[model samples]
Target chain A: MPDTTTQPLVRVIAAKKDYPLGHRIVQALRGVTLDIASHSFVVMQGPSGSGKTTLLNLIGGIDQPTAGSVFVAGQDTSKLGDSELSRFRAQRLGFVFQNFNLIPVLSAAENIEYPLRLNKVPAPEARARALAMLASMGLSEEAHQRPAELSGGQCQRVAVGRALVTRPDLVIADEPTANLDSATGAKIIELMREMRDRLGTTFLISTHDPQVAALAERMLMMRDGLLCDA
Target chain B: MTSWSLAFRNVWRNTRRSSATMIAIALSCAGLMLFGGYIYWAHLAAEIHTVVLSGHLQVFKSGFKAKGSGNPAAYALANYDEIKKLLLADPVLGPKIDLVTGQLMVNGIITSAEQQTSSTFAGVGAFPDEIERVIYWNPYGLTEARQIPANKHLFARKPELDAADPEGITIGEGLARLLEVSGDSRASLELTALTPAGGLPNMLSATVRQTSIRAMEEIDNHLVVMPITMANDLVFPGEPMHVTAVQLLLKHTEDLHTVEQRIDELAREHQLDIEHRSGWDLNPNHERSLNMLDMFFAFSFCIVGVVLVFTIYNTMMMSIVERTREIGAMRTMGVTRHGIVTMFLQESVVLGLFGGLAGVVTGLVAAWCINHSMILYTPPYFNVKAKLELMCLHSPMIIVGSFFSSFTVAMIGAYIPARHASRMEIAEALRH
Candidate 1:
């Protein structure tokens, strides 16, 4: 067993989020608490407007809770300044979105190399790592192709490769497979599970697909700004 | 991908927009360059014209500028040959001097006996070959005043005062008109002046050799140019050679100030009462006109620069709006706000380089065409027309400055938009 397995990669405690919408306050999360163990695959399933994304954003350090603290990779995310938060996210957290979010101007391999470049990695090493990641993803032949040239499944795979190429402590994937078809989405989920198993990197995914949820080691649910057991 | 390569690629993401932005940059650069070239032409025109009329520097007896017009005889420097020898042998000025000559300015009554007309006249007496060099000093190959066909008679190529014809005189067209005498070789005239020592009357006679126009109408109406021997004999009768002013033409006009300083030192050493004027100082109107043009150039550059700034700003803003989501992705990947701004500024640098290069090439080509076309223009106070030419090649700073201005304007325009893009809420930008 990995030494990090004993400690959780993420901790959320009584996080409360509220914002004024026009004239009224909308509570997106209310005193929610959670933990995600290192090297574990976790999933949060919720319907639209059920605050799953809001909670994920809180854990991602992109949004702060109104009355709580969240820790990721051993640092209190809410206490970090904007630049520090950016660095924290860049070094410790990875994100996979529903839209794939590939830079259209860059090729598949270049897209995978983007995060490494951000981490101040040298160009030759970054390219080597990106190419290695592409081979591991079984898309080496399509390395030079742009995101537009790739199918929906290949783009999601490239996004996943990009997320894991930096080998961060945790990958926060919100609807990573939403844009792909069922078979493609299943392959993408399988790819992520394989990455987690091989690299010992923790994953916190949000999904509505029960099939994807069935493969998670731990499952949580959110509705009306509160969390519940699956 | 490296940030620079990424930025370069992003600059071309919207080809049409990028091209349009670059075109705006290029047009502004070319326009500024052309205008600067014209200003360069004006500078040269003023310098050469001043040199042609007065040499690079003229040394006058002290107080001549204040009172010499009323009594030039009193202000005339005595022992002209000695002063000329001293000027030619001086350590500081000897090597720099291209030509050293003396002129006698005399005013008296002139009579055209055959025409039965007489008029008060202002006369200049000078060495034929040396004064000819001063009048035809076109170092920059400016349109020669005498060479213009329309000015052929006005600026007759032959020496104005010939040594062979000791009694010959060249008179201004206005003066000849007043005397009712053409530039006929047979036109006879007599001049009368007072001897300096006792105010005794003295007279000399000459035949009209040519009639030419002067730049200033007031001077042209009563002007006479004759050999120095006749002038000295007419004004001082039995005295040695005396000169109202010594004209010094230098090999390089840039040496005028230094030579003037040395002349001042020489004056003090010899205890000679002398004052000097540069070609630039002699032509006040030309200096004022150039100053006005300089002001216009400054105003033009500001207006053009501001417009270019807004143009680049608008272009950058549009690109940023289109790439909001992309910015969010990079931010999430740990790109700092400074990093994001750097990327966009790099794009502007590319725009500046390519656009500036294209603009310089276009400006040069356009300037060459205009210079070759031989377009004609008559400047203010000039009776002869000159070729309208742009001196772009002759002035390199204008090229570099125009290019740099475009680059700087593009950067200024991109800065605000780049900063705005960097400040976008990461999650919100992702949502967009």
Candidate 2:
């Protein structure tokens, strides 16, 4: 038996995914197995349509595997229903998107406070924690600005703040810097490293940017829907 | 931020689109309210006209309505005073009754001496003060009082009839015209009729005091108003007074059925074989008109509902399509499908509340403006032109119904799109 005391935070065993395209089934993920330890910063590098986003979606509980199983925080996500998966995502996982998907209507601080509010945190405490998170991102002066009012780097920081505000056990980022300039991309990558180090949260990122890949503690390469050894 | 606050802000994202949808809802609500208010006012006006033309309930001898038309005096109630006293003393009915009076009918020919013109006439004899109360003292006051045309004011004003003018009579304007009697001229006319017992012709003379415009165009050509005592003396000289029927006016028409029941019980106790008829029973044409008006109101309401539903549905569907990515993001941030639906519904509710409230306010203001305006038009079967008035604020049900219907329909419109949004696959939604 494997050691339970030092068991990985995420365990994927021979996971596979297939999507129906019109009249045919397209394989998005081939049989893949991986283990990510706690507090590890891992990056999966791939070109377009190489199944990196699909893998990130499976790990984040946004999609279920067509076969095999995915275990996150000791719960088998493949067996969970849609509603249970949603709750699991809320309590144990967070996501950062390529386009910095901060709710356009909410202020920067309010967007960060949203997940905490969903978790039933008291209003004042949620507000204070959102402010603290914003300050930590060096965005205290832009707390009251909406996504439309902020620059791309500022918006990405707010998105990062929102993902980490709930202190989830795992954070998944899909092409986080694809929409940003090189300078902004480097800064966002630096912020994510600092956050992972300080909060001891596991980070799983899918990217084609070498600057992002250079910061990964465990780097995996994917091509043709299969992960190859580094 | 709270879901409600988020929803509130989201609605304003597309200012022009949201405002247009809200305006559609507001207009629908106001249109329904105004049409409903007009129908209500028409109902009240028609009811009052019927009651004043014929009292709320009329008591007749057992066979009067069916058999008395051919020989009215023979089927007339002989103990008229006794029946009036019994009606006035009824414990359950007395307080509800506003006025009770006896009437006598005289069918005769009127001859204008100076003009040398003769015409057939149907005449009613009533108590002067009681007729005044029935015609003028409506519960709705000035709004109802204005329903009586200027030419008919004599029926509701001074000198409708009096002892000093025991022989004074009011005739319809068409009848006066047939007799060649103008408003400026004073004239005397001779009435000839057949007595009940002798079947012999009898004649009496009366001074033409006033001319009125009653409801029906045909009635206006042959109607005469006189005193009951004069009618009795002309029909049965020196005999005890007799009347065709006793008419009752009530404080409220809603109590007609209850009052009719009590009157029937009283008639039974007194051992009188009598039948009672309500205003609606006597005025079938008025009731038919009211039914058509009710149909018009229902048709208008359905139209408003359909248009409003489609408007709100289109608005919400477009909004959902535009925010597809944002919805996916929220789902990714741990908002449940139910949460997404709730947020959209909350936005719809806010729209409905604001739109419905604006509609009610606009409807009330429009009603006031119409009531105060001098818009006039002649209605079918009416002898005089009537004022156009809408009674919106007086009807609480219409106001509440308008708001509730708009709000409910708006929610229904939002629900379809919200459900669609909630069931969307996150991956496809993100791609959108």
Candidate 3:
């Protein structure tokens, strides 16, 4: 088995992200520091307005911190330009979403191959990687079908396949099972954990669901933009 | 496998929007292409007409254009051969020349043998072969009329100065009608001109060989062309041949301004008192017609732009409204604000390309159909009837220009929606 106590791949140093919500200045992240170690599944759990998704975004380098730093695998993403951050994301980060944001026009297989294309990966390699990822999701048969042609659970499977196809160091999932039924959600959680076990990759999730929170190796509980419990 | 494929596929997802936008683009492209094609054809046609009627440039005696009628014989090129050699010997201008012919204008009276009526006409003296080359006066020239033997017979006879052949002379179609003259195989007319010899005006007579009408109504109604050798014998008598004007054909029609400037310098240097006129200067009405065509094209382009903006804007707004949650999901999935911008821009480009292609097909088909249907038209200013001619050129420029325009319009329409999508908070998006 892989060592579960490996060094952290992502380190947040008192990160702060604020927004102007009408006349009030909303603090999405308030000097919150966190570490997401390699080969560990981490969950950020909170109710609405808890900044769980904002924390995930900061660590993934999709959004910059207002006052502090988000470092991924030793690189401070806050210092990178827009194009550089995108390249970094393509190389090191994978993302899965609650609504399974598979591009509706593309086939399930194409959705999985999108990031690979953006990275200008060779076609043969991209195709092989997409096929293997689809097989792992048990969606190889529906590879050519569009997202609209698939059910909610099937669409999420494609989204997961998409996230994993890049084979990135970190996977950030924002309520990946929020759109599925209980049984489908459970199966999805199992699939994620199974991938983690096989690949020895880190998974970070932001969710309010108790079931998802329970499956994490560690959970960070947030309330009103502050880390209440770890 | 390519980014292009991704962009293309996204455009078709909303079929209604895609088709609507595409149709809009296609209509705009077709409008521009067809109108542009017509303008191109008109410009070419006008250029040909100018060359056929007036040659490339005309040289007149210093006072001939101002007051030639008072003493027509006095204002003439005394050394015709020297001027002709100067025009034909220039290295750059020689190869482009077809003729350096001379013409002498005079007031004349015509009377057909078949009738007793007589009408005034304008007589033009020219070199038969050279004038034929410049005017291309054969029946095979432009229109689809059967080859007439009149120009051929005129070419063969090479009529010279002869007072006895008064029954043989060429009259303009309109002038022939006014004089009631028949250009029948056996029939002919009489022509008499008032020429000057030794500074004294004298009467001269010649025969009308054939009747003809080119595009110029004024020239056709009154022109009476005769050989330069014959015209000189009648007008100058014992003296040398004198030409009122020297018509020059340049190597390239587009080089008229340069040649005119050169001619001006040469005239000044050589102490030759003369004035040079380009073909366009002699035809102001043709220039006005071309300007009107340009205005029509400009108006059509404005219409196309307005239609395209509205079409693309409607499609993009609908797409943004439909894909609200999807945009949010992409944000949470680590798609940055710029990525969202790129994605939307890519979609717009795809739509523009596809729409432009469809528009090209649609426009070309409409234009081809219109062209083939023999759509005869008489514009407000023109007296002659002409068929609508659309020559699309099928060049890389038209295709690329049309496609770019369509794509740009789509981008403009999508700008606001894409901006709105990019601004969606990841937290708010994930909640939905």
Listed per model, the TM-scores of chain A against the true chain A are 0.96, 0.97, 0.95
Docking class of 1: medium
> Which stretches of candidate 1 lie above 4 Å from their native place?
A1-7, A20-26, B108-121, B147-153, B173-186, B192-203, B213-223
Give the per-residue lDDT digits (tens) of candidate 3, residues B271-365.
Answer: 88888778888777778899988898778777777777777777777777677777765554456678777777788887777777887787678
What DockQ class does candidate 2 belong to?
medium
List fnat, each candidate. 0.76, 0.63, 0.28
Interface DockQ of each model: 0.75, 0.72, 0.30
In terms of DockQ, the best-performing candidate is 1
List pairs with backbone clashes in candidate 1.
none
Candidate 3 clashing pairs, residues 3+ apart or interchain: B26-B359, B96-B251, B168-B207, B168-B208, B169-B207, B169-B208, B169-B209, B170-B208, B170-B209
Model 1 chain B: worst 10 consecutive residues (lDDT sum): B142-151
The per-residue C-alpha lDDT of model 2 at residue B7 equals 82
Task: Name the candidate that leads on TM-score.
Answer: 2
lDDT of 2 by residue, B6-106 (tens): 88898899999988888888888888888888888888888888887788999999998898766677778889888988888888888999888988888
Encode model 1's per-residue lDDT on B90-179: one tens digit a residue.
Answer: 988999999999989999899988889999999998887677888777778766656666567676556787888888889988899899
Per-residue lDDT of model 2, residues A127-181, tens digit only: 9999999999999999999999999999999999999999999999999999999
